[model samples]
Target: MLKNLEYLKSGNEKQRRAFKVINQLNMMEDLKIYSPILCGTIPLSIDTASSDLDIIMEVHDFSGFGDKINFLYGPFPQFKLKRKIIRSKLIVKANFIYDNFEFELFGQAQPVTQQYAYLHMVIEKYLLDTNPSWRCEIIALKERGFKTEQAFCHMLELTGDPYEALINYGLRKQII
Candidate 1:
């Protein structure tokens, strides 16, 4: 029932709605859902009216999984599909805007940085586990249009890659 993610259940109405969708999606046994780790402001429990859902999912087959999502969302009224180079490797990301939230899909074959970002979600979860005060700071940054990773870096006063900062956090805390 996605019980461990207590933040989502306690968030605002929009977050609850997003959680419903994610929970439903999580039940799809045919697909490799990968926990649907909530990213962005949603997981931080600081969802503003402008907040949108950011779910990072790992799938076995990108095309097949995307086709299923496209069929369900009906081609995403406003959608974008693109490729970005990360860590010297090209990774494709498909974004869909549904109910004013952004849903992003990343395949398992993505680059190192892309994979690291997903892994960062886990690290963020653990960090928030002990102290959630950073939620307020992150939400404010997100409202100003800073990306989730950027917000993490800025709030933590960490330099370089946000993923690396999180990795260091995990190392220091011995949570990895």
Candidate 2:
């Protein structure tokens, strides 16, 4: 499912719509050079009405990437772009709304496989598939305003910075 967007076509209503919007915008082909992968709640079927589409990519050229995305999706409603450092690593992000689904394109110089979004999704999917009950529990936590990682951490009794803790758990369990 992570290798391509094809699975989304047969997923729930939201996933189908996500597939449409992504294709309609020619997102994959346009960003093909960067190797885009949609990673987040939608694919896991744990999303809420407010969940945004998170597309992660490996980008080496910030300037070129920013220029390309701005050219392609900049005209969309609420489109915005920014570059900032997170955990001391540079990242480029673009946000926009299309077909009522918020789209967040996150790019970092690191490999997509190494990005936190991708890693988290892999671990989250594993956990959700591990216990059917946890899916509802995690979603319930999300509805209560917990971020995905936070919800998972809370449910797992992980006690540190949720992000790092979850990743650490994944690493220890070889799940990420």
Q: Give the winner by TM-score.
A: 2
Report the lDDT tens digits of candidate 2 across residue range 1-176: 77788999999999999999999999999899998999999999999989999999999999999999999999999999999999999999999999899999999999899999999999998998888799888888899999999999998999989989999999999996
lDDT of 1 by residue, 18-131 (tens): 767766656234333544444555665656676556555565565666676665554666766555676775555667776566676554564323467555665666666666
Worst 10 residues of 2 by lDDT: 1-10
RMSD (Å) of each candidate, 1 decimal: 4.0, 0.7
**Candidate 1 runs further than 4 Å off:** 1-10, 22-30, 33-36, 110-114
Please give the TM-score that candidate 1 achieves against the real structure. Answer: 0.69
- Residue clash pairs of candidate 2: none
Q: Tell me the whole-model lDDT of each prediction, alpha carbons only.
A: 0.62, 0.93
Query: Residue 141 of candidate 2: its Cα lDDT?
Result: 89
Tell me the lDDT of model 2 at 9: 90
Candidate 1 local distance difference test against the native: 0.62
